[model samples]
Target: MASTAHRVCMAMLALPAIALAHGEIVVDVGHTLAAPGATSARGRSEFEFNLDLAREVTAALQARGRSARLINEDGLIPSLKARPQAAEGAAFLLSIHHDSVNAFELQPWQWQGQALDYNDDFAGHSLFVSRDNPDTARSILCARIIGARLQRMGFEPTYKNGRRRAYADPMHAVHYYDGLAVLRHATMPAVLFEAGVIKNRDEELLLRDPARIARMADGIATALVACLTAGQPADDEATADGPPLQPVVE
Candidate 1:
C-alpha cells in the first residue's frame, strides 16, 4: 500500500490544470454615470464612450470563449473606491476611458453655431499601468501587449502632454500611473486604456462610430486572449514600500 503522503501527492497530480480561456476578466467602465468623465468636442460624455467600449470588449471576449464581466454600476452602488475591490477574484481587470486635454489647451470653437470646447492639438490612444498593484509586472506586460495590438490595428498613440500631465512617458505611449485608483488597488493584473483623445474633433467622431469601436474591441479582446495564453511575464516581483499615489480622474 502507498504511504499517505504519496497518496495525497498522487491526488494533487490527478487534478486538471486551470485553463486560461476560462479565467475571469473584469472590464471596468472608467467612471460612474453620475460623474461621467471628460466631455468630448461634440459634447458627448466620456462615460458613454467608456461604457459602450467596455460592453463591446466584454462581448468580444465572451465570443472568444473567455469569461468576462463588466463592472459598470452607477455612482450609488459601488463607489469609486469600491470598484477595484469588486474585481477581487478576476484574473485581469481592464478599465476603459476616453482622454481629454487640459483646459489651457482647449480652444473655443463654433459647432453648429454653438460655442464648444475643442482640442485638435493631440490625438490617439494611451495605455496605463500602476506599479502599486500587487501584480504590477503582469499589468505592465498586458498593457504593452494591448498597446502593440492597438498600433497594429492602425491606431496611433498620443504622446503629447502639456505641463500638468505627469503620469505618462508620451514617447512610449504607455504610462506608469501609480495614482490611478482602479489600477493601483486591483489585486490582479490591471490596465487602464485611454482609447483616444475625445477632445479632438476628428477623433471624437471616430470614437462614436460603431465599426471603429468594434475594431478596437476586437483588438483588445485578442490582446487579452494572448496575454492569458502566453502566461504572466517573468518579472513577478511585488512592491509594497512606495508611498501611496493619488488618484487621477479618468
Candidate 2:
C-alpha cells in the first residue's frame, strides 16, 4: 500500500504545470494602513481608495467566473517584495493605486479648516510596467489592454509628468517605470495602475463617487479577462525602455 501511495504521489508531481501557470489573477492593493500612500485632496489615504477599488475588481472578476485573489486586502502587507512573493503563481499582478503629483506642484488649500496640498494641473489615469520583470512583454500588453479599455470608457490619460517617466505607449499612457518594486519583482506579468490623480481636487471628487468607482472596477475586470484569454502577443511587440538616470543639462 505504501509503494502504491508513493507512486500516486510521484505521478501527481509529474503532471504538467500548465494549469497552475494559468492561476488566479492577483489584484494587489498598494500601500498599507500604517504607511498609507499619497494623501488625497480631501485627506483620504490612497490605501483607502486602493482597497475599495480592489474589492470591487475582485468581486467583478469572480462574477465573471474568473479566478481572482486580492493581496494586502487588510492593508497589512508591508514589504513591496513580499507583495509579489505572495503572488508567486498568479497569472498576472495588477497593483492598484491612486496618483499624486510632486511636492513642488502641490498648492496649499483649506479643507474643513485643515490645510492640505493638491495639484489640479493634471487629471487622468496612468499605467506602468517594469522592464525588469521576467514577463515584461506580457506586462506591457496587459497595461495597454487596461489603458485602452479605460480610455474607451471615457477615462482620459495623463501626460504631464515626463521628468523620470518614459512612455511605452504614449497614446494609452502606459509608462515603462522599472523602479516600481512590485512590478520589477513580480515573476508574472505585472501592471501598476494609477486609477486617477487624487491630488487633483476635481478628479478626486469624480473618483470618490461609488458609481464611478464601480464603473472603473468593471473596466479593469473586463480588460484583465480579455488579456488572459486573448492570444499572447509576440515578445517583440512590447518594448519597454525607461527614462535616463540623469537629466539632460541642455
Candidate 3:
C-alpha cells in the first residue's frame, strides 16, 4: 500500500515538469482595429498584416506541440498600456507588426485612381527589444535566435530608418527600441517583430503571399522552440544592458 502511494506521488510530480517543457507563448497582434498601424503602399492596413502573421505563427507553434495563444481582439480592444498585461505568466511574448518609413520619406502615388502613399526605399524585416524589461537578457537572446533564423531563410533585416536617425541602433540585426511600451512592461521575455517594410510596393506584394508568411512563421517557431528548450539563465546571471548599438547606415 505504501509503495502504491509513493508511485502515485512521483507520477504527479513528473507531470508538471513535462508540461513545462512545452511552455506557453503569447503571440500578440500589434495595434487595434480603430487605430490600425502603418498603411501599405497598396493601401492595406498594418493591422491586417499583423493579424495574419500572428495567426500563422500561432498555428506553426501549435503544430510543433507548443502551447501558443494569439491575443486577438474583436474591435478597438486593449490599449498599448494594457496589452502587456495579457502576457502575464507566459514564457515569452512576441508582438507582430509591419514596418513603414517616416512621413518625409513618403512619395505621392496613385492606386485605383486614388492618391496613395509609398516608400520603396527600404525593404527588409527588423527585430526589437527593450532595456527596461525585467528579463532583458532572455529577450535579447530570443531576438538573436529569431533574427538568425530569419536570415538563414534568406530574409533580410531592415536597417533603414528613413529620416529618423536616432532609430539606427542595430546589434546583430536586432534594434534596441527601449521606449516601446509593450516590451518595456511585459513581465516575461518579449520581442517586437517588424516582419517587413509594407510601404515598399514590392515588399507589400511579398507580405501578401501566403507561402512567404508561412516560411517566416516557420522560422519564428523554430527559433522560439530552440530558445525555450535551452532554458533561460538565472535572473542574477542575466543583465539588462544589451550589446552596443552601431551607427546607422543608409
Candidate 4:
C-alpha cells in the first residue's frame, strides 16, 4: 500500500507547469481617458497607430518564437467590464497611446535657441501590479526595453518642466509608475505608454508612418521577451498610488 501511494505521488509531482510557458503578452491599444472630445479623425488616427504598432510587435515576436497577441480590436477598446477573466493568467498587458495634448509654444526651445512647439504630450510611462506579491517584474522589464528603443529612435522626451530633454543614454524614463484601472484589475503586470505626441506636427507625422509604428511595436515585443527571460515572479503589492490609466502620458 505504501509503494502504491508513493507511485501516485510521483505521478502528480511529474505534471508539467500549467502556466503558459510561452506566455501571452496582451496588448490593449484603445487608450481613452484624458483628451476629452478626442473621438475625431485626428483622435482616431492616433489610436490606430497604437494598434499598428502592437501588430508589428506581435509579428516580430512570432518571428522570434515568442507567442504574443492583441486583446483589443482595431480602433476599439476592449470591454474589460464585460470580460475581466481574459486578463487572468496573461503574462502582461501593454496599453498603448499617442499623447493628445493641446498645442503649446516653447520659448528659446528651453534647451536650444529654436522656437519649439509640440502637440505631443510625451507622457510615456508604465504601471505594474499593486497586489501583494504582484508579479510585475516581467512587465517592468518590458517597459524598460520599449523606453530604451524609443529614446534611441529620437523620440524627444517631454519633461515635467515642459521642456524636451535630451534622451539620457541608458536611462530613459520611458518607464514610470501608475496605478491605473488596467493595472489594478489586471491579474498580471500591466503598463501604458504614450508612444509619442500625435498632435505635434513632427510627432503626428511620425505616428502616421507605418515604418515608425512597426519599429515601436518591434521594440515592445523585444522588451517583453527580455522580461520573460528573467526568472522572477511579480513582487509584493506596492503601497504607492500609481498614476491613472485614462489620462495616459502625453
Candidate 5:
C-alpha cells in the first residue's frame, strides 16, 4: 500500500506534463475537401477553397512542430448523413463553412407574396459551436480563441449580427439542435467557422485573394496551437493578421 501511494503521487505530479499531449486536429471542409463534381457547384459555396486552406494550415502546424492530421472530406459525408460516430481517437474536429443570403433566394415572395421586410443584417465572420455542457463549452471556447486571433489579425468582424438566432428560423446560426448536418453529427466536440459572408460581392472578391486565404489558415492554425491543444511552441507566433477585411457590398 505504501509503494502504491508513492507511485500514485508521482503520477498525479506528472498530470500537467501530459495535459498537452495535443493530439491531431481533424478538419472537415463543410462541403467536400476532395475533388469537386460537376453536379456540385465547385467554388460556389464558402468552403470551395477550404481544402486548400486546410493544406496551408496543416503545413504551418507541422512547421511549428505540432502533431495534426486532416480527415478526408469523403469520410465526413457518412458522418454527416446521420448522428456522429464515437469520438474514439480524436482530440478535436473543426468544420469550415461559408454562408450567404442565398438561403432567402430559395424562399422568395414571403409573407403573402410580399417580401419580408428584413435586411441581410448578417455580415462578417463568426466562430460557433454547440451549446451543450463541459465539452461543448470547451469547444466553444476553442472557437472563441480562434475568433480572438482573428480580431488580433485585424479582421473587424461585425459579429453575430444576424436577424435570426435559431437555425430553424434564421438562415444561419445552425450549430445545435438545428445546426448544419456536419456540425450536428460530429463525433467529437466540433466547431463550424463561417469565415466570411460569401453572399456579399465585396467579401466574395476577398475570398479570391490567395493571401487572405493563407492568412485565414494561419490564424486557424495559430489559434489551435496557442489555445485549443496547448501545443509546444516552436518559435514566434504567427497569426492571420492581415489588412482590414472589407465589408461585402450588396
Candidate 6:
C-alpha cells in the first residue's frame, strides 16, 4: 500500500515539469498604430483587432499552464524585422493580423457618414509560414496543426488572398509565404495568422463577437500545446485540466 501511494505522489509531482517542457510562446500582435495593417469595413484599424485577439490567445495559452507572452502589445513595434527580434528566446512565435482584400476588390461606401471601402467577397481565416526561416520544418508543422484545429473548431479557411500558389497543406489552408519578414526573420519556428477578412462586413461583425473570439483563442491554445508535445505520450490529465476560456469582454 505504501509503495502505491509513493508512486502516485511522484506522478502528481511530475505534472509541472511536463507542462514546462513546451517552453515559451511569444504572441506577436501584428502591425502598429502608425501602420495599422488594414481598415475594417467600418473604418476601424486592424491593429485594434490584432491586439485584442492576441491578448485573448495569450490568456488562453496561460490557462493551459503553458508559458506564453505577448510582444508589441502597445502598438509600438517599429519595423517588420524588429517584430521577430522582440520574440527572441521563445520556442514559437505567432503573429496575429486581420485580413483585407485587394484595392480593386473593395467598393466605396459610407459608414456613419464617413467614406469607407469594403469587400464582401472574402470571409475566412488563413495561415502562413515562411520557407526561408531557419526552422521552416517546425514552422510548417505548427501552422498545419493550427490550421487543422481551427477548422475542427468551425473556423473556415479562406484563400481570397490570391496567394494559394504554395500551400504547405491545402486542405487546412496553410500557405508558404516565403518573404514575410516576421516569419523569415524569427529565430524560432513562427507562423503568421490572418485571423479573418475584416473588410468583409459580415466577417467583421463575426470577428468582433466576444464568444467567437474566445472560441478561436481556445482552439489556438489547444493546438499549440498539441504541436509542441506531438511525439509524447498522451496526458489525459493535462489535456483535460483546463476549462474553456470565457468570452473576452474588450
Best-matching candidate per TM-score: 2
Cα lDDT tens digits, model 2, 1-250, are 1244443443343213353235688899999989999999989999999999899999998887889999999989868899999998777889999889989989999999989989999999889877656656667777888889999999898986455687778889888777778887787778999999999999999988999999999998898888777746554433332332333221
Between prediction 2 and prediction 5, the one with superior lDDT is 2
- lDDT of model 3 at position 25: 89
- Writing each residue's lDDT as its tens digit, candidate 4 over 1-250 gives 1244443443342212234346676666554333221322233455566666767766887776876676555444445432224555666667666555543432112214434344433444322332211333444545556666666766545453223321212255533333345655566656666666554555566667888677766666666666565534333111222223233321
Per-model TM-score on C-alpha atoms: 0.83, 0.86, 0.83, 0.63, 0.63, 0.83
Please tell me which predicted candidate would have the highest lDDT against the true structure: 2
Task: Give the winner by TM-score: 4 or 6.
Answer: 6
Query: On TM-score, who's better, 2 or 6?
Result: 2
Backbone clashes in each candidate structure, one number apiece? 0, 0, 0, 15, 3, 0
Show model 3 residue runs off by greater than 4 Å: 1-21, 73-75, 162-171, 231-237, 242-250
**What global local distance difference test value does model 6 have?**
0.78
Residue pairs with backbone overlap in model 1: none
* Candidate 3 structure, TM-score to reference: 0.83
Candidate lDDT (C-alpha), each? 0.76, 0.80, 0.77, 0.50, 0.51, 0.78
Q: What's model 3's overall lDDT?
A: 0.77
Q: List where candidate 5 sits over 4 angstroms from the true fold.
A: 1-21, 33-43, 74-76, 79-88, 105-122, 132-134, 166-181, 230-250
Question: Which ten contiguous residues of candidate 2 have the minimum total lDDT?
Answer: 241-250
**Model 6 pairs in collision:** none
